[model samples]
Target: MDVRLLAASAAFALVSSITPGPNNLMLASSGLAFGFRRTLPLLLGVQAGFQCLLLAVAAGLGVVFQRHAEVQWALKLVGAAYLLYLAHGLWRSSSTGSAAMDRPIGFFKAAAFQVLNPKAWMMCLSAVGAYTLAGAAYWPSVWRLVALFFVLGLPSITLWAVFGSAFRAAFQNPETARRVGRALAVVTGASCLLVLL
Candidate 1:
């Protein structure tokens, strides 16, 4: 890839990775409820799943979407439904006595979440479309795009969790924690509006 193009791609990856989208909102909520360490699986899942999605898009999933327009439409519907489901779950979150006993979106589940995450899909598709070079070096370019996202994404998303964890002390109170959970639910639910758009 050309130097200017690579730089532009990196910038896009950074902005998209760090922005307050569905993943970031959920990660922040998870961090507030479960703490940083407990939220690791969710983080890992997002990265792994998004990497796979980017690879698939790079390998011609975009073309498939072009050929079968209905497929994209169907995927969008499914994605929207999943977002609504997640929003409902967040809105109804109950206070857990123990972090260990509480299951906050596990590794495999989080990874699978990417399929339903419209933001994740958009990021992957945009990355592949904007970065991957045509010809022999295409795969390499895709890998680099993945690297750019991974390197930026892991840290970018982590910051949201860290920000949430900063309020861990305030959440020590049970009543306060419940309110926080409700607030997070609102935020998470609002993030799902993007899917509707």
Candidate 2:
């Protein structure tokens, strides 16, 4: 891989990973509700899931997506529905502070969620297409991009979680927490628009 291309890929990974999407939004919400330590599993899961996604895209999954518009549409519909469901749950939990809110998203669940995350798909597809080389150098280049993303992305996503956790103290009051939770839920639900687009 060219050093310049690798550096550009690193910047892409950092920006994409840290941006406010479903994963980061959920991570922040989880951090606020569960604190950083409790949210660590979800954080790790996002990284693991995204890496798997990037690998798959590098290995030709992007071709499958391109060839089958129906499949992509199906994924989009399902992803949008799932995000709506999660948004509802978040909204409800904010109002009642339900037992469901007490439990954070687990590692496996978060990992699996990548399959339905449109942003993850976009990031993986874009990264693989843009950063990789052809033929003999392809695998090596892909690996480099993967490692770069893994290194840069960790701290980027971690910042989102930390940002949310930082607000935990201020949101301790029931009313304040509920208001914040509801707002987060709205944003989460709105993210589904990105999926459909």
Candidate 3:
């Protein structure tokens, strides 16, 4: 793959990966409660999941979904429902309890989340459309594209985890932590909804 093209793709991937969204919000929360070390699964999940989505999109699956209005609507509905479910989970947890916050979410669950995540879809669409070269050798281009996103994605997601871990110091009380978690959850879900709009 061309180095210039690779660099450009990586740059675009960084912009999307680092941006505020549901994934970032959840990462922040996880990092705060579980610390960067524990958030590794979540970070890996984000990269692996997006990598799959990018592959699918490059294979023209996104175009298929884009062509079908009903399919798109169904995806939105599912995404909304999932966000609400996440919101409820966040709300039910202790607002300030460090014990409750210590455990990060499991890997499989986080990986599955990418399927219904609107933000993930948006990122994939953007990457496939903007980064992947149209006329270049298909396999090389795809590999390079995937590499660009993966390279930027891991660090970007980790940063959110670190941000969350950093916030731990601010909430010494379980009650305060619970309240903040609930609030962050709400914002996270809301951010997902905005992608549908």
Alpha-carbon RMSD, candidate 1: 2.5
Cα lDDT tens digits for candidate 2, 40-149: 99999988998998899888898999799998998899889988987898899787865226599989999999998888998998999888889899999999988988
Poorly placed runs, candidate 1 (over 4 Å): 94-101
Candidate 3 has an lDDT of 0.76
* Better-scoring candidate (lDDT), 1 or 2: 2
TM-score of 3: 0.86
RMSD in order of candidates: 2.5, 1.3, 2.5
Best by lDDT: 2
Instruction: For each candidate, give its TM-score against the true structure.
Output: 0.88, 0.95, 0.86
User: How many times do residue backbones clash in model 3?
Assistant: 13
TM-score ranking of the models = 2, 1, 3
Candidate 1, residues 97-179: lDDT per residue as tens digits? 33312577888988887877778878887888778888898888888898898888889988988887788788788777777
Expressed as tens digits, the lDDT of each residue in 96-131 for candidate 3 is: 353434377777778877777887887888877766
* Cα displacement (Å) at residue 98, model 1: 9.7
